[model samples]
Target: MAFDGIVVASLASELKHKLLNGRISKIAQPEADELLLTVKSTECQYRLSISADASLPLVYLTSKNKPSPMTAPNFCMLLRKHISGGRIVDIWQPGLERIIHFTIEHLDELGDLCRKDLIVEIMGKHSNIIFCNDQGKIIDSIKHVSAQMSSVREVLPGREYFIPDTMQKVDPLTVTSEEFAAHLTGKPMPLAKAIYTSFTGISPVTAEEICSLAGMDSSVPAQEYSADILLHLYTQFEIYLSAIKEDTFSPGIYFDGKEPKEFSALPLSHFVNYTRVEYDSVSEVLETYYSTRSLITRIRQKSVDLRHVVQTGLERNRKKYDLQLRQLKDTENREKFKVYGELINTYGYNLEEGAKTLECLNYYTNEMVSIPMDPLKTPQENSQRYFAKYNKQKRTFEALSVLCKETLDEITYLESIQTALDIALTEDDLAEIKEELTNSGYIRRKYTKKKVKIKNKPLHYISSDGYHMYVGKNNLQNEELTFHFAVGNDWWFHAKQAPGSHVIVKTHGDELPDRTFEEAARLAAYYSSMRGSDKVEIDYVEKKQVKKPNGGKPGFVVYYTNYSMVIDSDISNIEELE
Candidate 1:
């Protein structure tokens, strides 16, 4: 679910409650698509994370720190100059249009109070972060859009900042009974589609929830409903809207067919009674769902190539093993053929020229060996029998040769895969490793067409300063968290070996004290499959040192000199993420 409007609205609400009247102590763009805002409230300090990546745009309060480029990007410097130490006056969402605007009041260079607007558009494929002056003139944006970049609107400096219009059919929260009745009277659309199309704030999930509350089939034809039924639905929808206004929301799951699949904050019982139902706050629902989904996506994408490489090796080994087994069988057949040939040659002349059978003295075993032949057999027939046995033995030798070569090749392939899996640190690397297994026939492909499960759980650790560190389980996750989730100046750690996950320590820009390093080391050890060894060799390198190898295996990298340590593999001291 690409950071839909509802999630943004929930986040904006949370931010407003926590950050209003708070001063922005620091601002940093640790990554091009991510922002970390340090807000100082009277009760506590808050680290607000905002990301504009289309797949997982989010605004959440976290306690984690991240690593950033040594030299701040021009954009980072610009934000620091303009908005640092600003007081957050308000957090506003534009009627669930996938946009959040932060109104900040700060002292200008002349020491005069000024207000600036920081707008974040959460719409997928069109998401952006723009900084505008009080006059609504965009000073700069995270992404520069010109007439050339977007024919629809130019987002460069000096342009007016305005929300782009999205055509919607109805106001879900304010639609009157008469208006809804008029819209649905002649339309023959599905109930879910009609509601979703009618309202700007209504997602498919919400639409289904409305249908559930009204006791109507979400898939039922809208035109088929009786006027009385329609009136009932409108009344129910009004009640649902009232619930939203009162903030009395519940989380529910949705299903396609029998599988309990998608999750939502609206009750989907009207459409299907999803067996796996859970209730959570609107904020909790967005945070948990998007966080897990983002993590899984990161792991799969980052590990894709590495998994492929490993799986390919595994497959080659399996084939080689099979071929060797076949050759072993053929070799046994050859030995039998050799014995047959020797017996025939020894008993050939002992019998009459046309003899059907003869017994020969076995010189080696001190026993009689019997040779049988065709009745009235000629010299040519006797010669043919000996030659056929000889040929069978020769064919066995050839099979053995091919088998030896294939076996060696397979061994080499298996070894490579093992090595790759050992060095895997990130979810991306794991994804590649898993893919390799699937491709090599080690694991069967999952039949469901939806996204594959990339990482089972995030790699977790406690830093020396008691900060939590998270490592991605696959490539996609690595990209998401490392580049999109982490803040600048936080220590980044990775195993020095091969393709691995990108480990991030959320430091909030404080210098990493020693305990953090040990915690990170433990994480590196546990995440690798070599988790049971007494001492596992780990290479601790800054995330900046880790460079993705070009066209290399997913999560594969080349790092310069890094700190090395041999740490005990026990991870009991580290806390696992829930």
Candidate 2:
């Protein structure tokens, strides 16, 4: 996420090496604020994509091509007229600023050679792609700014194009140690904040990383550290900046589990326990990181409605389950009512007329018991009344016992669906879950002549012992994987008494190794509803021992004999197969 000055410098170096003296073969304005240039060099043909979007400004080399409009925009036409066959002379960054300057040499209308500069400013909402003459006079831009829009500088035709000195931050790439110490120690904020605020184009992420490299807590105040410690910090800062100076860029994306958390042109040693995937080039890093992030964001947006549906279903089922359990608790006194009927029959014959109470010896526990009576009713009638009440209570208990069990089963089924939704990574996964919901009557099924096809497959992984493991992504997949795909000798694993995926390991008739078992158990724990717990209980059994109940819900299975283990949910080391 920190596409700061260092990233810009890396990109500028890449572009200069690849497109230096390269001819601009094609010009495209795919989006209003974006440009895709086809540059032909002696080495290879490249597509350089640039975007000045207010929300997301990006510059990356891509192989993928986007469709341009039928008619080019005015700015596109202008660029095609002036610099269509221009050769890139230089590509550079302006002293650790989030900006890239490209100088192109081309022949004018009368064959006189001319040079123009294309500046891409990545300043968040103020980002712009300004085209200017060699004298720094603006010619045209992808987006124009007037005095009304910004009082600092205007990006219109014939206006001077310059970077605004808004924050007055010093260039970190060339700052001396004495100067660095003097400026950083004077700040009143935390150490990380002071570092970012004192330097140009250094994001808070980078500042924290710098502090981490110095082995200092970034949250401490800047002035609390002594001069010796400050000098050590400066040493670490120089070491970090040396990577950019030597052009030994190590580009990669850091992943927290499956999602990309951040990407950098240099090593981020402070991001402990995160997965760092190294790339050969910064363009590859940017393209991979942004595309993956976009897909994750798109999937989350699409799942909003589906999540609401599942959440609503879970809430309703949970409420019903609680109420049913309470009602079943009330039926616990049904046995006492039956005993009262017997005691009333035994002692009613000796009761005096107009008596309000009868004292008797209960045969059940051989203890003395007193039964209340209706004074106007005969002993026979009193006993009959007690018997009637016992029969009603018995029927109610019988009905509620079955109802409570059904409600509980429903709650468990809905919870499994909820867990499936949590791990849903693709539209097809959500579709399969929706189909399950429709079949289960939670959602109204729409009748059609042709059924929608579900193409989601179980997640596949290979254990360190070379065993193939498959994890279900939804309840239906769980049912398919456990009952149809797995054989008798294969092992099955699941979170103990929790809604989770059914993890099946293909044993090929051999007994699983202990390491493979633990790995499979970890997979079960990681995919379950209790995924983040320090320890999760897992149950494993042979496929033959795991049986689905007749007419049970999908993914519902029972096992009498199984092995249990407690393990953590760290699956970063587990090798996943596509």
Candidate 3:
């Protein structure tokens, strides 16, 4: 998500409207690198949060206030001493850069009026909150970057406050067409990169949006753009920068499936494929995007251990299955041994007591066969030896065939669990998966004998034709959906021959519309392993036709007959129910 200059500009506009002429009533530093200020405006009280965290630099108007430490830090105390009752005169951004300057007027110790600038730079690792004199010379900062840390500029006391790494960018708000053309022709980078690199406050997302608006390919070099294309791109740039200049902004977040993907100050038109969640306030958008994205990332990290276990189990069982298949193939010749024993017993009476070999016609194939015998043994003894060899091979085949089937079944079950983990979204979803693993013997049950009640339920969606579609989130859910929830004549869909969610389309004793069938097939394809494939073959059958073998693994089913279709995995048009 980009918290770029446009967003900062919008935020600056909002602050100027709300905090200008307001008094700084209190200052608190709850975190080592964070500051929470309570501003008292004529209208109401506002809590402004500004963080200079190296990992997450943020500036937002929050309703919640954090508890401060018993002893404030040096920076916090300094801010309190100087700006405790200062009146905010102006709030502004510096030429589309990710920086905000707050000008304050207050009385000094001798009652002399003085002015200071509280500058907050939102650059990633080099972010800092520096208190500067009216001349823009640094007084003190939350973070002081010495000459040893950065050669470009020193941010210590008395040093000049200049934005690093953005000194050369031409402000998009002020660039002329000639200037734009010069910069466009100067860079031999991709269209998107050139736009962002040449202009201040333009992020890669905004650059791509500009390219999309101009109908130019973002990946192609700017040099490859024709003169007319360049003109068109410059027109689109003006359209966007004009909005920022006019103080009109749209704050929103884009979502991929149900997960928050990115947020921006302006509508992200380039993300046509993702769902858009719009907000009236940029602060709200930022807070929601970061918090939701953080939770999704956290859940994925937590599932890594379970994923590793499933992957390792799948690999081991797959290898064992291959070996068992080879062993089963070896036993394919077991029937030949039994046939040889039969021929020997039938023709052995013609052999003399001292004969070393016997030749006879095999009745099974009407072909000649020879059996070698031990000269020291009688014909009856030789026949018994062949019979014993045949019986041993038959026993080996019987044992290995069962073992091979079990290994294959285990492999399939593990794969289904892996797919479930992929679509898992919450802690409860993961809890259900863990429970399934424990039941399937992949995970050992805890000795405490306490179980976490599973609240995770199947995905529910309504088809365009108004039919209900239920998708299993795990193998256990698949079993529950099919055996207990579904009934005869209800349609079931799965990604044919691939691991996927069990999609049951409820018929309710009525014929399902064609649109409903298509929607259910799309759901089946999207939640499966082949989700992003161009085409996924789906098998749809009546729930009654989908039968589970007794004692089979959860979600394991057999369908002797079914209807099939090839469909894409895009389910954006389908409406999902909570």
Candidate 4:
């Protein structure tokens, strides 16, 4: 993610090695702010992709080719006219900055030998690809930056092309030890911040790595360090720069769980526990990191609508359940009303004509009690009215009890869907969840003659003891995995009283080892709503003991007894099968 100066330096070295004497065979603009050049080397053909995209500026060698428009853009046509058949003379980075300069020699329109430079600046929003003559006079750029748009420098035709030093950062490659110490001590920022802010091409991640290598706290202010500590920090910084200087780059991507977290030109020793997959080519690392990261982001955005539906349903059901409980509590006094009716009937014979009240000794509690009387009605009539009121309340209580349970079940179901969405990694996984919602009436089903089949399957993992474990990704998957796929001898595992994936471990008619049991519990806890908790209680029972209630919701199961264990949700060590 930190495409800093070191990465640019490494990329420049690679391009120089591959394209130094290569001829530009073709020039194509596949996007508004991108160029794909086919370079013909003596050994092989390479596609050099250069992008000045405001969001994702990149320059890399790619094997993939993109479709171009029928008419080329002005910049692409200009490059074709000047350097289409030009030989790449040199490729270099500018003093550890995130910039690459490609020098080319070719015949001009006037049949005279000329040289031009194609410069790519990977400066985030300010990134640009500018074509310039040997004198550093810009001919044109992929993006035009007028004086009004940027006062620092203009990237228009005929303007002087230069890298603006607005940050006043010293180049790490040439910085002396004295200057390094002075910059660190003078800055009023954290150690890592000071390091990155004082040096060109050093990102915050790299700064942290430097601090980590020096065994210093990156959060501490740089000025707070002692003189000796500052010297030690500088030593570590030199060691880091030495790797880039010696061209001993270890290009790789770091992964947390299954997600790509970071990439570096050199091994990030700071990420000690993360899985680092080394690559021979830095271009491969960049491409893999960006594509995978973009996919994850895209999937999250796609699931937002489904998440909103689940959230809204959960909110409505939860509110209704609270109200139902209150109404049900009101009916708790229905038995007292029935007793009032009985006491009134028992004392009705001794009542005087048109009596206003009746006093009685209630046998229920052996206590004297008085019942209110309607002046115009007989005692028998009054008793009948009380009985009617009791009957109405008793009916309401019965209906509300059923409604409360149903609403509660609905909330749990929606929550399970939410958890499934969190666990979803692909489109088919989402399709299964959407189908479940449609069947359960949370979403409207689209009418179609042909039903689309979903190919999403449960997550399969192998325990340390070599036992195979399956985890359901959604409610429907959980049902399918538990009842049809699993055997009676297999073991079922889930997070206790929580919405999660159903994990079924195949025992294969042999007793499961304790290690396998704990691993299964970890998997169950990891895919549940309590995944963030330090420890989650898990329930594991034989598949035979778990039963689906008649007409119950998918994935809804009950068991009389089960073995319980509390485990952490760290399944990073667990081996997952594709």
Please name the candidate that would achieve the greatest lDDT relative to the true structure: 4
Q: Which stretches of candidate 1 lie over 4 Å from their true place?
A: 184-188, 250-263, 266-287, 298-578
Residue 462 alpha-carbon offset, candidate 4, angstroms? 3.0
| Tens digits of lDDT, candidate 1, 1-578 | 33445555656766777889999998888888888889998889998877877666767777777787888888778889988999999998876677889999999999999999999887666778899999999999888888987877889999988875556456565677888987766467898888777766677777777788887998987888888999999988887667456655565444321223566544455443234445444445555566555565665566566556656666766776777777666655554445555666666655577677667776677787665667676544665775686687678678777767656645543554564455454555566556766655667788776876554455565654678798766554555665567755555665544334567888776677776677676666655555545576777655565666554433445667677877754555456566
TM-scores for every predicted model? 0.53, 0.91, 0.85, 0.88
Give the least accurate 10-residue stretch of model 4, judged by summed lDDT: 266-275
RMSD of each: 16.0, 2.9, 4.1, 3.7
For candidate 3, write residues 315-398 as lDDT tens digits.
Answer: 999999989888878877777777767777888877888887788998989989787888888777887787787788789889
Residue 2 shift from truth in candidate 4, angstroms: 3.2
Residue-pair clashes per candidate: 42, 0, 0, 0
By lDDT, highest first, what's the ranking?
4, 2, 3, 1
Q: Please give, for residues 466-543, the per-residue lDDT of candidate 4 as tens digits.
A: 999999999999999999999999999999999999999999999999999999999999899988577899999999
**Which sections of candidate 4 miss by over 4 Å?**
110-112, 328-398, 532-534
| TM-score (C-alpha) between model 4 and the true structure | 0.88
lDDT of 3: 0.89
- Candidate 3 regions with alpha-carbon error over 4 angstroms: 165-167, 326-401, 449-451, 464-466
User: lDDT value for candidate 4?
Assistant: 0.92
Q: Which ten residues in a row have the lowest lDDT in candidate 2?
A: 328-337
